[model samples]
Target: MRIVATNPDQTQAVGKKLAALLQPGDLILLAGDLGAGKTTFTKGLALGLGIKRNIKSPTFTLIREYKEGRLPLYHMDVYRLEDGGAEDLGLEEYFNGDGVSVVEWASFIPEELPAEYLEIRLNKDETDDNKRYIDFNAQGKHYEKLVAKLAE
Candidate 1:
């Protein structure tokens, strides 16, 4: 599904909506350029899940875990592992853990990903810095329904 967000708030709203339908072990892959609102969307998801802590990008730390939410949020930024290092992170532990996993720059660790996932790609509008084009691509039936329900 393709969604156009005229502003960051709208983009976050979409993420918040998706969060309501999430289940444990859900995998979310966020793809986009720098400052494309990936983290912003995540903040919304966290909020929807009743998490009150401040959400930040895990660019350097790799993975930031937030367990205060309805379900734990395993937020990861694998961009730094573009060359190698995924094996050292033991990413499988988080993917299989009892939480909702959101991976930024997931392409860097494609080999480490599960067979199924929801990949959301964000593209910044050329004319509007705050505008983004969000595309949701589901790799399994579970995610397909999640996306359908999110649109509602």
Candidate 2:
């Protein structure tokens, strides 16, 4: 599915909607460029998960864990990771843990990813500074159902 966001708020709203459909062990792979509002969308997901604390990108830290929400949110940014660094982190724990995982720059660690996941790709609209084009692609039956629900 393709979604158009006129502003950061809209992008976040989209994330909020997706959050409602998330389940434990769910994986969401986010792909986008710099200043693409990936963190903004994540903040909305945090809110939807019942988290109230401040949310920030984990670019330098590699991963940020939020447990206050209904489900734990393991937000990861592997942008700085080298080829084998992701393996050292034992990412499987989070991906298979009792929470939802959102990986930013997921392409950096494709080999570490699980068999099923929801991929969200965000792109800036060339004509509008605040506009974003978001695409959602499912990799498994569960994710297909989730995307179908989002469509409804």
Candidate 3:
């Protein structure tokens, strides 16, 4: 599916919509460049999950956990990883845990991700300042359910 985001709030709204469809052990992979509103979308996700605390990118920390929501939120930014794969960060635990995981710069840690995921790509539009085109591609049966829910 394709979504047109005219501003940060729109992007967040999109995330909120997706968040409603999330389940435990689900992995949401976000792919995009810096300043592409990935964090903005995450904030909306946090809100949708019933989390009121401040939601910030874990760029420096590698992973940030939030348990105040309906399900735990394991927010991760893999942009800082150097060499080793999931073993380096022991990130396999998070992927297999009982929570919803949203990984920013997920492409940087492809091998660490599940066999399937709800992949979201954000792209800047050259025609406008707040314009963005977001794409959603699902893989595996689990994501197929998510896609169907998202369509509804």
Candidate 4:
């Protein structure tokens, strides 16, 4: 599914909607360029999950955990692992554990990803700095349904 966000708020609204449909063990892969509002989207997710804490990018720390929400949130940024070594992080545990996992720059650790997951790509419009095209690509039946509900 393709979602057009005219501004940051709209993009974050999309994230809130998706967060409502998330279940334990859900894996969401976010692929986008810098300044694409990935972190902004996640802030909305945190709010939807009942997390009141600040939601920041995990770029430097690699992973940030928020357990105050209805479901724990494991936000990860593996961009720093571009050269390899993601295996040491035990990413599968988070992907398979209770609570949802949202991965940024997931392509860096393709081998660590589960077979079934949701991939979201944020493409910025060249002509409009604030516009973003959020593309959803489901990798499994469950994700397909999730995307359908999100579109609704």
Give each model's whole-structure lDDT.
Answer: 0.92, 0.92, 0.86, 0.94
Which residue pairs in candidate 1 have backbone atoms (N, alpha carbon, C) closer than 3 angstroms, thus clashing? none
Candidate 2 residue lDDT tens string, 1-152: 99999999999999998899899999999888999889988998998999998999999999999999989999999999855588899799999999999999988888999889999999999889899999999999999999999989
- Tens digits of per-residue lDDT for model 3, 1-152: 88999999999998888888888889888888898888998998998999999999899998999999988999999887745455677677887888889898877777777798888898889878688888988999889888878878
Task: Give the TM-scores of the predictions, in the order they appear.
Answer: 0.97, 0.97, 0.94, 0.98
Local error of candidate 4 at residue 140 (angstroms) = 0.4
Error of 4 at 111 (Å): 0.8
| Candidate achieving the largest lDDT | 4
Model 2 weakest 10-residue run by lDDT: 81-90
Candidate 2, residue 14: lDDT? 93
Backbone clash numbers for all candidates listed: 0, 0, 0, 0
- Consecutive 10-residue window with the lowest summed lDDT within model 1: 11-20
Q: Candidate 4: misplaced stretches above 4 Å? A: none
Model 4 clash pairs are: none
The full ranking of all candidates by lDDT, starting with the best, is 4, 1, 2, 3
Question: How do the residues 1-152 of candidate 4 rate in per-residue lDDT, one tens digit apiece?
Answer: 99999999999899888999999999999999999889988988888898999999999999999999989999999999999999999999999999999999999998998899999999899999999999999999999999999988
